[model samples]
Target: MDIQKDQILETRVRLELDAKDLRNYAKKATGYSFALEDIAEHLESTVELLKSIEKLKSQEEQDQYQIGQQVVYVDEFMPDTVEIITSIVDGWVSFNNGSRGCIAVMIRPANQDEIKANKRLMVA
Candidate 1:
């Protein structure tokens, strides 16, 4: 068989084994025999749900921030300094200095005016 078919067969076999194990556990724990087919169906649904959740998480991270984008510090002290986004983390963003330094700022998107003003400040 081809690679795709082989992988599908392997996944099905693993699911069947997992369902059987669950059924055995249920029988031992509650003195009742759970249907193997039902268990397998539930497991498949759970796998699909997990895949969807992972996709959403990845999209959320992408939407949070982008590298090389220009943003402004939300501080009164340097409110007009244009900073280039270099990296983003859970609660902060890292910026590269126009020359050779780097600094981290809060992860906040700046408006167009703020970015333009910062650019003007840098020029001045």
Candidate 2:
């Protein structure tokens, strides 16, 4: 399966992370097809690094990551404040008393003419 770089998540990633962590969740889980042979044949990195990362991720035994729980940063959707993504409805994600007191915001999906009006901004 072709993976979108944007949607790829990690249990723990660095700042502005926008990369996917392709690893198995459990012993019974279907493992990733990214073997050292595959990496050597297809990508530039050495087999050792590949094996190392694979070992680390496997030893970690992580789950499907959550939004704020060690997010792989996407520049397009990087929220300065990191919190558990409480709820997403109709494309709008609700935050818990977030920056600028923005409790509610209009939805902004990727496709279509996605735009939002700042409704929570109080006029002084």
Candidate 3:
């Protein structure tokens, strides 16, 4: 059977993003990590309860980075900080403290009429 072109393209992008995110999460957690198949099982899940649980995602994102001027941004409370970055007054970000007492900032952006929304269906 032939594969659909759009699905193949979208799947590649999604896999890339998923790997990046899982690696980032793993790097921040302690000790070893679960198997990739196990992680995929957890990711395929869509339970709201899992969303609230907030367990560590991956073991690579924490232990994998070099710490000399490569980090972009992270909380001071976090360990294994490798690099930090600021937008130099050019970026607008929004954040909320949720139930916690942390301070937060809000951002609102305006776009031109010709701008297009982001999509993961990238073509190589």
Which is the leading candidate under TM-score?
1
Candidate 1 lDDT for residue 28: 68
Question: Over 4 Å off in model 2, which ranges?
Answer: 1-73, 97-124
**Cα lDDT of model 2 by residue, 25-82, tens digit:** 2222354454533433333233334445545443332223323431212233444323
Q: How well does model 1 score by local distance difference test?
A: 0.56
Instruction: Give the per-residue Cα lDDT of candidate 3 at 110.
Output: 16
| lDDT tens digits, residue span 1-124, model 1 | 3223234455656765786677667666643445554675698776565555545554564466778887664555554566677765642456773332233333356667757666423322
Model 1 CA deviation exceeding 4 Å by range: 1-24, 27-31, 36-44, 72-82, 88-93, 97-106, 119-124
Q: TM-score for all predictions?
A: 0.40, 0.19, 0.27
Query: Model 3, 1-124: lDDT tens per residue?
Result: 6444344445555655676576666667566445554564455453323332222211222233322212212343333222222221112221221121111111112122212322112211
In model 1, which range of ten residues has the least summed lDDT?
97-106
Q: Candidate 3: misplaced stretches above 4 Å? A: 34-124
